[model samples]
Target: MQANQSRKTGVLLVNLGTPDSPEVPDVRKYLREFLMDERVIDIPFPNRWALVNLIIAPFRAPKSAKVYKELWEERGSPLKFYGEDIEKMLQAHLGDRYFVKLAMRYQNPGIPEGLAAFQKAGLSKIVVVPFFPQYASATTGSVYQKVMDVVSGWQTIPEITFTNTFFDHPKFVEHFATAARKYIAERPYDYFLFSYHGVPERQIRKGDVSGHTCQFGACCETLRADNRLCYRAQCFETTRLLARELGLKEGTYSTAFQSRLGKDPWIQPYTEDMVKKLAAEGKKNVLAFSPAFVADCLETTIEVGEEYKEVFEANGGSHWQLVESLNNSPLYVELLADLIHQRES
Candidate 1:
């Protein structure tokens, strides 16, 4: 292969995905595809299939569809809309040197379509940037695997590179801090909550190359070489970096995980529990941040913003405000552009 003899490179930006519509059937189809992934459920094929088809998809789809309805804007899913905007902004920022395309890992504009654009552009090098800020087997890992599966059959495969994680990137931290500052100046918050998406404890332990090191204690307190790919550790590291940037003190802020499924144990101090605890402790006002999500999706907008707010108020808290996700923000677009340039250089 002659490397396509082109100076251009391809940037494929992938996000978790959204249902094409809020209808039950569409949500069910999306859930079936998403929950069936082995990396996500982390179970045997038969068990995973049974869980998705027989139990989860059938039961959760209608309820999840309602939530998606609440999240949908006039232009449709905020996740998809912001993703498209970010792709366009990033393309403009990178200019003629890069061909940028966006994809949703599960639904419309999937991995195959994104890679096909790169192939059509005759670009010899492709960069796969999973939208996940933290490296997780279920999210970023799955995206990388799907990208390879799509490109493996090509006669002349491009030089594909993957970004495993960028949780502690300075610009990423700065963007969140700046967003939080905008809210802080407007109102007084008694505490700050950093809520990240939850995964099973087993998932974290499974990714531990250094066996038995990812125990729920000091093991994940710092970002060490052994725990480099541990998702929980990276989430905590993100919280720490953002807290420092926002000039937050130790007791003033806390970290929690959200959106857990199944009966299995998930990474803790769960978000729901944290909200109740804060209310019980007489913390009347709190500012919540979901740094794990770059776009304002169901999790950030409905889960933390609406559902959690209700929980806090019902439990006796007066105010619960969620700091918005970095949805197509200028800083966020610049951050993505910087990452692309670094990878290309």
Candidate 2:
């Protein structure tokens, strides 16, 4: 624990982590922590472990280390810095009534370190908010588990509560849509693409809400019941809602998935394939949005910003504009403030 000022209510901001450093060894450590999670891998332990250590870690580390180097600035990982900035901004907005600290689920400055900071602050009540906007077993559930792992050992545990999901929060969509419009004003773009992280179809079935959900195209029929926990349907619904808010036509935009890990089939319309399709169809200009992530990370920064950009350019497309992520922008800060206030109310 870093002070011991009693009466502070702690707010821990959790995000997916990054490498401890831009070097290959550190990147490998981060990858191991991230890929080793059963939720992330979603396979029998033996198979997942063998696949990761043998194939992914052996070949991908050096390449990923270079990518990490590109992302690292004077302050280090953008995920860390952005998470910290949001926490600090949210703390100021919430006033001294709370102590805010950022924690990564994997790698350096993890839950242990963040909890220690809060413990030192002498906070007895805590509210944990995972950075994932959508509730997926892999990301949100992982945070939920690790947080419990930390708080379980505490002799003086706070009244801890975990926010399950905020995908449908009005302020969340409003803030994201505002950013989208602001960036593409007067820009000539034919389509808006909302790309969310992908999980296998089987994982979707695992979280199926009774027999009626995870029905994909059919799930939209029961939007009210699924809520935020319906990862597959909600990704489409988020796109639908935001498209409506922006006064866009039905065919003006599309939603797809990115970041599939293995051979097992993930949710369809993969982003990489989607990019090629757009380019092949002679679509010259497109704008992409990744609202599933409130802050930019590897998925948003590299996959959407660069790799997909390469896809469009390679396919003879003229323009590919990525709508910047929310990060610590004013509207996003306001959205967080509203979330906290909503919780209070």
Candidate 3:
């Protein structure tokens, strides 16, 4: 059956997905829609389409396919695998009282399909977890929009709750920071780089809670009512707060953005630029942190571990480290459980 109509609580694990195959056509299909989302690229359609198709699709497809090759294990995309693992673990913990499923925003197992799975199961309350620690219009908000679109026609909507952002969640901080600390503990590092996927600066300003607070510096510091989820602001705040928890000194750390597409200005201190400068400044040992993600994916694996490592070493940096994402870490699973407990409470 396509779906069941039950009244049990449902938990949906949603993430930005990868193509089913590494082939250029499959990769292109994924990239076409992923990049074209006005929320993701936020550029004019013609320019965005031309840039993605003529430029990025042609050039990036083959290269990205190679990276995907590295990321593909026996289970396929690590994002999907770990997402499934998280769901299973959570289900094991929660038992038959709740239903848990995974959803990908862009590709297969989409929100609609995932929703249908729940609707088929007859779930009446659903929790949408987008797996991004920071709430961005591009990630978490987009997932919510997609879910709403799918369930709009339903005679009844589930009691939907989303754990929008978990940067400050104690379990979350413990999972990634502890993993990073363990990795860096044995090494002497000159600087720590917290790199998040970049979004256009315009998006931040456009949603600037108040007309005046989206300056990207002062606004994102303390997590005020206005800058709650400002992409740039939230990234910085997550970095700062985490750094404080980890006992990092002021100059010992910096925040930068990676995975930027096209020429439109993105919020920065770009990660690539940071790598060069750190190398130029003679910082021999550097650490890269991708706190935005709870699980490892192409962005964390190939982009930071491989691509940025090459840039740093080639520029004369002696050591570069890409910290692992919190992939099925016991604490991370515990974190998800705690979130479930909180929600159910």
Which candidate number has the best lDDT?
1
Checking candidate 1 for backbone clashes, the offending pairs are none
TM-scores of all models? 0.97, 0.93, 0.93
For each candidate, the alpha-carbon lDDT, in order, equals: 0.89, 0.81, 0.82
Q: Which is the better candidate, 1 or 3, if ranked by lDDT?
A: 1
lDDT digits (tens) for residues 1-345 of candidate 1: 112344478888999999999999999999999999889999999999998999999999999999999888999999999999998888878877778889999999899988887797788789989999998899999998898888888999978888777777788898888888988998888899999999999998888877878888787789888888888888888989998888899999998999999899999989999999999999998999999999999999999999999999999999888888889899888878778778868
Pick the winner on TM-score between candidates 1 and 3. Answer: 1
Q: Provide the lDDT at 65 for model 1.
A: 96
Q: Which residues of candidate 2, in runs, are more than 4 Å off?
A: 1-7, 209-212
Worst 10 residues of 2 by lDDT: 1-10
Q: Candidate 1: what lDDT?
A: 0.89
lDDT tens digits by residue: candidate 2, 229-262:
7787778878887888888887778989998876
Alpha-carbon RMSD of each model: 2.4, 2.0, 2.1
Where is the poorest 10-residue window by lDDT in model 1? 1-10
Order the numbered candidates by lDDT, best leading.
1, 3, 2
- Residue 40 in model 1: lDDT: 95
Clash tally, candidates in order = 0, 1, 6
